[model samples]
Structure formats: structure tokens, C-alpha cells
Target: MYCSANGFPALVVLKMNGLEYLEDWTVEEGAMANLKHLKIRRCGNLKMIPEGFRHVTTLQELVLRLQPSEFFERVQENGLDWFKIKHARSIVTKR
Candidate 1:
């Protein structure tokens, strides 16, 4: 999914499922500006988190489940995609 700026401006929490074919998600700067919690499940094909997440300063928590181990690793502290979500206070991943 590709989200542009100002999309879902009032959104505080978002949950997505059945995205097995989704390879990536892009969030443009300022998109989901008010989002605090995000959950993505059943997205086994997703490769990585979008770089634009760094712009989502309001994001507080992220939860990823039922995804590939490599995908989950990318969100770890020393992982490649960590910078995208470092601002989030909590990140949870479950196989």
C-alpha cells in the first residue's frame, strides 16, 4: 500500500491483514500523522518497512506478525530497516 501525505490524518490506530502479496508499503511524509499504533499481520511477502516511517514522528508502537523471519529481523535494533521505525517506543514481532 502506498500512502501519501495527509492520508488518514485523524487515524490513531491501524490494523491490516491478508496482505500476503504485498511486497512493500510506502508512507509519504506527513501521512498518518496522528497514528500512534500500527499492526500488520499475515503479510508473509512483505520485504521491509518503508523509509518514510521516519517521518511518522507520532508513531508510538508497531506490531508485525506472521511474517518471514528476515522481514522481522529487519526491524530489529541493528537491522537495515530499524532506522525507519526507531522513533517508535515499542516494536513487537511474532512468528
Candidate 2:
């Protein structure tokens, strides 16, 4: 489960689902610089969103659905992973 490697950062929207093997999702450094929206759905085995999100400074909205409870809990406001995504303008979660 890997995306093609490239140097230019132009992606603006990303959606992923059903990636059981994807334990960690990382957008390459300096890549996805324009990414403004992201959605992750039904990825049961992806324990947590990748730590690299802090580098996606332009990310404005994030939506996560059908993820593990523990994973979701960790990303809750004031949770351990909250800081990584705190800069996102909007964060939504659905069970």
C-alpha cells in the first residue's frame, strides 16, 4: 500500500479506505503541500493517522470514519494525537 513517489507537491484532495495493511499513512515531506481535504474511511487496521500530518500545513479539513475506537480516542481533542492535527480547521469523526 504505497503511493507513487514524486517531488512536486500539488495534491489537494485525498481519500482512502479498506486499507487493512496500512498501519501508518504518511504524506511525503514537502509533498501534498496544497492538500486541503483528507478523508479516511473503513481502515480498520490503520491504528492511527500518520504523524507526518503536522507537515501538511495547508490541510484544512479531515474526516475519519469506521476506525478503531482506540485510534479514534487517541485523536480526540486533548488526546495524545490531537496536537498533530490541531491546526486543521475542521476535524470530523463518525462511528
TM-score of each: 0.93, 0.85
* Weakest lDDT window of 10 consecutive positions for candidate 2: 1-10
Pairing residues by index, what is the TM-score of model 1?
0.93
RMSD of 1: 1.0
Best by lDDT: 1
lDDT of 1 at 41: 93
Question: What is candidate 1's lDDT per residue for 7-87, written digit by digit as tens?
Answer: 889999999887878997888998999999999898888888988889999999999988889988898898999999999
Shift in Å, residue 95, candidate 1: 1.5
Worst 10 residues of 1 by lDDT: 16-25
Residue-level error in angstroms, candidate 2, position 13:
0.4
| Per-model lDDT | 0.90, 0.80
